[model samples]
Target: MTESRGQAPRSGLSYLPGEAATDPDGTLTAIGRSWTWILGSAIATLVPGVLVLVWPDETLHVLAVLIGLYLLLTGAFRFVTAFGREHGERVPGLLVAVLFVLAGVLCLRHPMQTVAALSLIVGLTWLVSGILTLYAALAAPDLPHRGVVVGVALLGIVAGIVVLAMPTASARALTRLLGLWLVLLGIGELVFAFAWRAALRRGDALPGAAGPMD
Candidate 1:
């Protein structure tokens, strides 16, 4: 089935079975493209979570600042990554990046906001990002390792729901819960980064695949 012409189209990095082999230099170009930005995004998320957990005594102000930094850094990484994706598949990644930046700005602007406000900001961001990612994966018929992508998206959705549903009366509680979820989400994204890299390599190894671009 063909995509409707009227629709603007959904986008993200994806490749189909044997697609790399058939496209001249496309597979090589993709393989040569560093997937490290995803790794960096994972690290950006992991560091803030680790710090929040380790510094449990830190005030709400400190926590907000940390989260804001994390979001901003992640957004930057994702923005770079979005550009690397095939033209038709860049929207989801770009949107996610923008969302992170917006949320980061909010966190940084009001670092002194109460626990509920902070949670709401983070929760809604995650939930919306997750939905976007999941939709893209499902909509992309040729996406490789579809399961892994779906799994990562599901993880984020679960984290968002948990954070939103659980009532946190104090900074410490939010710290613990949000910190744990961040770690989990980071790990999930980390795994996804590696998985996608492996898939790209496999695509390049197929018969008739082009050599890596200079």
Candidate 2:
């Protein structure tokens, strides 16, 4: 049977070209359906972040292990989203997933590595993240709160540069900074998750909501 224009394909995996564009919700995908999981992950990230902050004296090995776990979880989430029945571009997601998984594996395998090496890894991660954020902000001219995103991207870039420049900084200080950043990131994720959920609810009345996985 010939599929009508704007009709979902039988694969039930993706939308027809321009289908998502015509949707009132912008784009309906498996990722949007997984908002609750994303929200939970965001909240889960806060736990270790808080613990690290409260116990700054924790051993470097312990901190490394915690960070590894966090990265692993983050990577797993990204991988799922990358290969899932999402209706948007997946190249960036795939790249990020690979980076997170590799970093997490390295951290886990070398928990006892020198502070300088670990700092370098963290710095690189932040630098890459900042670059990606800037790219995204520029790519999406219609993105809400574009100014705020650009500001955050700038801060991320500066933070990455500072960390790289001061690789000799005390391990405890670096750990504290990492912990603080994680906490803030987790909070932001939580807020975004809730907002996404709200938008999904509001979009439920639209035709896109009837799409597969919606």
36 Cα displacement, candidate 1 (Å): 1.1
lDDT of 2 by residue, 3-46 (tens): 22232222222334444543544333444334565565566567
Query: What does candidate 2 score in Cα RMSD to the true structure?
Result: 7.6
Q: What C-alpha lDDT values do all the predictions have?
A: 0.67, 0.58
Clashes of 2: 0
lDDT of 1 by residue, 1-214 (tens): 1221121112213343444554554543243234455676788888888888899788889989998998888777766665444555667777888998999999999999987788888888788888878876776655656677788788888878888987565668888888888888888778866765665555431111111000
Q: Which lDDT value does model 2 have at 115?
A: 65
Residue 27, candidate 1: alpha-carbon lDDT: 42
Q: Compared to the true structure, candidate 2 yields what TM-score? A: 0.71
| Index of the highest-lDDT prediction | 1
Candidate 2: clashing pairs of residues: none
